[model samples]
Target: MANELTISGRIVSVLPLQTGTSKSGHSWQKQEYILDTGGQYPKKVCFSLFGDSITKFPLQVGQDVTVSIDIESREWNNKWYTEVRAWNVTYASQQPQLQAQPPVAQPVPPQPQPAPQPQATGELPF
Candidate 1:
């Protein structure tokens, strides 16, 4: 909901929580995690959960989960940075999980080709 991007994958890494204070004297905490979408060409995405929600995400490496995140990009000092901010996290659904079936498309069987017959050279040399 609300233009959120949801992705499902197994947790590959969980970085330690980071705590800091804002310039306005407000404390903040953030936790980052990496998820791997296993397939022929596996992809890994790093996302972070901020604020009190960090405690809600008790994810561990090798656990399958679906996460809702917002992609953000900002420019600072003429440099651009991108962030994937996670808002919601839950266990992947039980129905037809990504790991339950093959990721690659099914192989197609080759069709039989006709063999070429020998050419009659010099009447087959009788």
Candidate 2:
């Protein structure tokens, strides 16, 4: 869409799923997740997936992804509310695997030797 925006980050949390039947007798589902833009000053954004999109993008915590979102606001009961809705989700990149390194041998320190005891004298002196 013309107003769509894209953001890339790691999934910080997955909120509880919400399900209900609409007034027109149709069932709907909504799922929300938090994304953290990692940098010097990280920012957290909460976005939602609706209906089949929830299953289409089975997001998980710690998974890196780029999401296309639409920002919209509505007024209800004289108050305005805004929502960040995600339309597309793609994996950013696979995390790099760390390889194991060979262990280094440590040097052992030498133990100290004990001093010899003095011999006992036989004669008693007064």
Candidate 3:
């Protein structure tokens, strides 16, 4: 199956680690990033990078990158929170050969319809 979301955007900001303890009694480190996709209104999507993915990408501000993300929604304390988890991310400059998609197939033309026939007018005989 195709990965849920693959978006190309520029990295706007990267947040420092906020230390917290998970329910499993393990320490968790969270880092958030703001990505601008250059839409009608530039979107700033927050992504969480943890462990090795953080070290692998080494996010920096003002870098153009494409992210393979998983979107998730959760309800906490009667409030909903959305998150974009980056499973794969790469610098745009590195993949110049894989830039564009092939053209989409055009739709076929509709067939012509037959003309409507007029009803015969006659004296009523019920």
Q: Give the top-scoring candidate (TM-score).
A: 2
CA error at residue 54 for candidate 3, angstroms:
1.0
**lDDT at residue 43 of model 3 (Cα atoms):** 82
Report how far residue 48 has shifted in candidate 3, in Å.
Answer: 1.5
What TM-score does model 1 achieve against the real structure? 0.69
TM-score order of candidates, top first: 2, 1, 3
Please, what is the TM-score per model? 0.69, 0.72, 0.66
lDDT of 3 by residue, 1-126 (tens): 765688888888888877788899998776789888987988877888876678788777778888988888999999998888888887876534324689999999999998756556754434
Question: lDDT per residue, candidate 1, 13-76, as tens digits?
Answer: 9999899999999999999999998888899999999997887777777788889889989999
As for candidate 1, its clashing pairs are: none
Top-down lDDT ranking = 2, 1, 3
lDDT of candidate 3 vs native?
Answer: 0.80
Off by over 4 Å in 2: 95-126
Candidate with more favorable, higher lDDT: 1 or 3: 1
Number of clashes in model 3?
A: 0
Model 1, global lDDT? 0.85
